[model samples]
Target: MTANETIHPTAPATEIDASCKLPLLALLVGASIWLVIGSVLAMIAAIKFHAPDFLGACPLLTYGRVAAAANDALVYGFCLPASLAVIIWVFARLSQTVYALPLVPVVAAHIWHLGVFVGIASILLGNSTGFAWLEFPRGGSILILVAFVLIAIPTAATFGFRRDRTLYPSHWFLLAALLWFPWSYASANIFLVSMPVRGVAQGVIDLWFGNNLLFVWFSLVGLGVAFYFLPKLTGRPLYSYFYAQYVFWTLVLFGTWCGIPAGSPFPAWIPTLSNFAGYLLIVPVLGVLIITVKTLAGAPVTSSSDPTVAYFIAGLIAFIISGITLHLVAHNDQLARITEFTWFGQAQTQLQIFGFLAMILFGALYYILPRVLGFDFIFPKVTRAHFWFNLLGSVALVIPLAIAGYEQGSHAYNLDAALPALRVSSMGLLLILIGNLLFAGNVLAMFLSWKITLVKSIFSAVTSPLKAVEVKS
Candidate 1:
């Protein structure tokens, strides 16, 4: 093939280095384990509402325990590792650097995974602070911080040692996310643990950290993956690089202070600042939408075959949907009537967790998995099953929760009987259980197939009889 044909001049996937695949593999394994465990706990937590009498007596298996474990696993277990995988890939690609020693990244991943194990265990033991998403025990938080620093070290080093002289729009998003995590985490730790902010300042710091978690950690990482995979999948250079650039810049600048899902009750300045910045998210949202549309406008046929593309596309839609919902939900008065520690809050989290982050991770895995395993997916049927189970299960689980939440919140707001409100919400909890079962089955099937294939290959190398028996079947 000519140099132009060989290099895949238009699409960006052609040049992806194979050596960068291992770190991604380790990360995905961690994510998959977490995803399965997290979703199951989420369902268990949801179900306990209806059958409060079911495991209510068990301290370790209590509703609070499961809820904390579920959210903690989802955040630290799935999202963090998965996003790091994307970061590894993007850093390698933009750096035009191959992994001279892949073991370093792998070691970093092991450290992160260890921290996740400790955090989940700590939370499940009822050592949490009862905070949403930041519920990991103090000891767990320290371990997680150490893990974060370890992972960030290689990323920062990659940036400094990069081959690509000019940074891409995606690079800005990645860097911003890396920076935001430490800032938000540190502030949250200080406020929630170290000094313990007093009165409204506590609420203010809580709002700041929560908003930062959503905008910077989840959205920034999601957007970064989108920025990379969308153009790469469409087989086009980024469309209107300037617009993409503007989107990245605006998001980092204005998306910082908008996390008052229950709205702020502080000084006028607090709410004003948060609300104003929340509205400003539109600048980046609209800008990126235009860029994505332009990039995918005339893509190659190969785009359809690429799971990465599909996943990236799904995440982009989720990001926009969540962004808009965030605005609608940020009204303190409106949320005051709706956010009564109910599933309504969990619904938005699901959108951010499963809808935005998980989808992107799926895309990242779709591309990274086959490359690392030295094979195409062992079974397309299993792959499709995994995707559908997660997609539908998330909707099935989240939608009913949202409905139940609204019912509970509306009733509570009007001073109705709490028991009746709880009873009504119980139905949604049942649906979540069914959804989790389906999702867990799908994940098990996918991993089992891979395991079988690997085992079969190993035996076949020793004797053709093993292969012949399989062929006969």
Candidate 2:
């Protein structure tokens, strides 16, 4: 097919449509709920940073546990399921086939959520593993792994049975992510739990796993959505299909190696390798930026009325900014100055997860929801509200945290001087909380409108029968 040739739209078979709709909706609902919950928890955590005594009386709401729970909920609970929904939809669309074993993904989503719920509960109950991303207890981790497999099975089958002979860039990225996540999750769990690494090696593994999960899994999924939607929405072909290959491999090979140096007692070469990987990542970032800019050339810089286009552009810009920030902070001198005991690292995390990945997913959901539901959004204003809230909230959140981190780092010796920065960061978190509330409200409105329509249809069906009988009499 020529570069500009759009994929032919195929009408999904009735059975296929029926099977996929509920599961996709379920994933969406689950993700939105988790987003709100995570936001609340995060707000509490951020507040505690400045006001340490706000909820210090409650053991269950301790800062450490609450922070861990919030992170876990946002990552596994919101982003994972949301990304899966997008991936499954894109896969089915590209394959020109209906999803098989629809119930499997739905069941798996429930199981995954259950696992996260239990894990967070465990953390609150003081059973956390204390291993950063692997804070979940062994049992919860096992449950998640199993759930992942269940979700992956149907995903693989969909790709395997694809009708189209040619694969798209989105397909490659999505497939790689699906494969990478399981490997990374299982490997990390094994090293951290099943067999258990020793001493500084544990830290090495932990950092490696965290970095890989962010770059290899989450970043890839976000990029894949961008690749598909950018061209589709703009009515343009990818600028260079061949360069997309370079973007993919560079990220897969080098991205996995770019872990934060933990000052561990391991061999010196490990940190060196990671630093080198971090610098090398600039290659893929630039490649993606070039492709995106070229593809979007001649398009409006921002379409305020179009949430999807606006969000996509915002996400792409954030991705580039985060990339540059990461490259700078990964340098040896910068790492010593900012990577640890500061909010700098947290800022980077927020930029990547919320700014880039979540924004792209939001755009994808806005695009996909209408297509699947077969109706226009009931509250277009709410959609616009969500976009503005997210964009403004992210800016309000990251900038202060980054400034605070730098100030706090520079004044490391004077604990009293850092208070102002902490308070400023707290204000940023408050904005994030407000933004999240808007998002949750928007999602709830969409579902409520759908439910109202369903109820009206059912009532009409029942009443029409009586009217027909009366007319006959």
Candidate 3:
């Protein structure tokens, strides 16, 4: 085991065992493939809705099924596993113990991925119960839940058994995210799928789960990665433990109860509960933002050197934008009407996925792959291509959708109008299709490049002249 210095000036340095970084690469490849597939489905749904004649009347390609599949692939297939890759790395780094049982994580990853496959298949086949996010049939839901339990429990156990008693801010966020899933998943499933919670309770549970998934799962992963990389990039400890703690508790307390109070029949108190939480989130968002600003306040050189840090910073900005919009929508019913359906929601989702999640993962891959494969990015041009294609496509897809959503919602609230809003919305839908296609192309190129490079290395005589050697560092 090699000892590594703690970034914090006050904390003692710790040692990390020599562990094979296999699962990290494997999970990343798996997630990337899924993202490509998910993006294709997204484009298909966008096209089908915009042009009914494009796909004819194929039952398999129905708008609803495709849309559901898109969400399923993105959530279950890509985001969760990618985030888990980061989690595993964090656990290993924090623990500084050699990978005791790497195969366990591999097994966990396989079970979870399989569960996602079944869940998506069920949804596509119209076996869904039609609840947002919880649309997987009971049978599928059970499998997915079992997978979640299998993965999450061990992850938590690993964290609990770590020798490091002094927890980092990133650890706090990661642990919270891990704990949050089981609770959120169980609550939503129990209400929407099992016995059923009627009326407002159902809506409340749904909103609760949705918001928690974003904050606890997605947001935590983003923040944890940021926490790790930012320090590593700057070669300094975080500017303030005080600030991070404030943000952490504020996010935890507020994140759990956010996302309710829009025209639902649920008791006024439910949204009121969420509204208070939403408002409180502003403190953490601003506090964390300030901490970020202070920490990197003078480190532009470092930031430029690390695209992952840049992506993370951008994601935080996006998250703040989403957080503010969420707060406003939760409080004012009229504003919610306008912003709720508008491209605003679309913007939020895109910002979180692309600006935050995708960028962080890309940066992580860039940082990790070299070590794992003992080589630099095979083609820097391809990396740039991936970044720009996805970046521009994301902006193009999300902006129109947000604007279109606003137009549709405004028209709906004002006069008896469906056709006019639908017409405008169609334009936004078209943009989404174009953006998705571009993203798909970008991802496809990445995979092809990865595959070709590996093949060339295996048979160098027929491929490039560059020698291929196993990474031994």
Candidate 4:
């Protein structure tokens, strides 16, 4: 690849990078800024579990508020925008077209981040809607929905104008994600926020939205990313290509019916039905694991040198672990009795979001950003550190929480048991805080490096004419 190929390449893949460069860069930069914000709040929320007085004086920093704010920031601010950016790039590349209506995403990026900021602020300020993922007030939720639609235009356009007719495995996932989120999000707002579902049905609707956003979107976008990049980075054809459709169909079929806890006040039949669907989901999870493992089996040793590979594998492991954990808790009556509403559930969430989803996105960003920015990573070594801290921090956080939750449950939620569990989970929280600091600092470093390079290029361009005039004179 020549310099031109890196920045202005005619090849379809690099062309895709160029076509969507400006919009995608904006989204990622926004995502990074939010990650730092959300990570700090999450750490604060975790600490309050063990040390209630950590920020006791400030009503604004209460555990409930901090946790909700953190969840909103990470999900809407970081994950959604970053995920949409990935979809845009993949869709364009696969469709073999320069992305159209790029301005829509650029505008959408501003609106989306604004919505996230306002929503998070609302939660911290005690104006949250009190719905799980829909804690954002009506105004914030509406803005977010509008912004999402705007950002999606280029994706829809690319697919419509595609030069390529045959769909790849990833196309199914990305396309499904593209079509699903808008309907799901819009309907949730209509049923839950705007009109308000009567009584218990509100909870059902919220769970439907939240679970779909978590599982369906993750399966579609996150796994879509893995499907594309794993074989790509490793230089191998995808293994078990035939099963790709099965994984897609099963997860899409069942993911929304998950997340209703056992022994909920809702009708017994509802929880039973949801749990059954959750158990069946293991089939798709195992399918993803098998195909991914087969592809990585004989992968060249040098592929691991990429650093992103480590993140990918760690995320895959986390995904499988979380999936199996979900299946077991749903299947075993005794296990649900012990773990329901405990830190065990929270552990499962962290594994799915930070461990599985975030790690996979981190890997994707590391690969995509350089091509879009037209520069090599300034601190390649930082990624190595990032990987270790990320892996260790997630392990420290999830494992301890799971044990704590179980111990707390075993002892029937006694203060003595709670105290010990809190202490253990707090240690994990501290490790996660350190890891987030590294991530934030590295993002800052990368930004500075890119800016410095940009300034030098401009300064040299401005001075070249004067140098030529002096030589000629």
Whole-model lDDT per candidate = 0.69, 0.80, 0.66, 0.80
In candidate 3, what are the lDDT values of residues 1-473, reduced to their tens digit?
Answer: 11223433222222221242545555556666677677768667766544776675777678888888887788777888878777776666675554446666667667667777777888888887777777777776776677666656656766776666678788888887777777788878987888896765676777678777765578777777777777776665776778888888887778778877555677677767777787677787787678778877787555247565655565667666666666667666787767764556656676667666766766665565555444455455455555555555555655555666666677764322333443454454344344444434444455557677778878876665767788998
lDDT of 2 by residue, 1-473 (tens): 22423355354543344456766777778778888888889999988866889889999999999999999888888888889988888787777788878889989888888888888899889999989888999878888888888888898898898877788888889998888888988998899888997777888889898988766687799889898888877777787778899999998988899866645467988987887888888888898899988988986655543558778888888888887776776655665565466777788788877789889998988877766666666765667777787888788778777776777678763446565766776666666667666666666677778788899999999777554335554
Model 4 misplacement above 4 A: 1-12, 302-304, 451-473
Candidate numbers sorted by lDDT from highest down: 4, 2, 1, 3
What TM-score would each prediction reach against the true structure?
0.82, 0.92, 0.83, 0.92
Give the Cα error of residue 278 in candidate 1, in Å.
Answer: 1.7
Candidate 2 lDDT trough over 10 residues, lowest sum: 1-10
Off by over 4 Å in 2: 1-7, 10-19, 301-305, 332-335, 413-417, 451-473
**Which residues of candidate 1, in runs, are more than 4 Å off?**
1-18, 261-265, 300-304, 331-342, 412-473
Q: Cα lDDT for residue 364, model 2?
A: 89
Cα error of candidate 1 at position 307, Å: 3.6
Error of 4 at 131 (Å): 0.8
lDDT of 1 by residue, 27-133 (tens): 66777678778867876776665567667787878887888898888788878888887787777666666644566667777777877888788777777776676
Worst 10 residues of 4 by lDDT: 1-10
Cα RMSD of all models vs. native, in order, equals 6.5, 3.3, 6.4, 3.8
Against the true structure, candidate 3 reaches a TM-score of: 0.83
Best by lDDT: 4
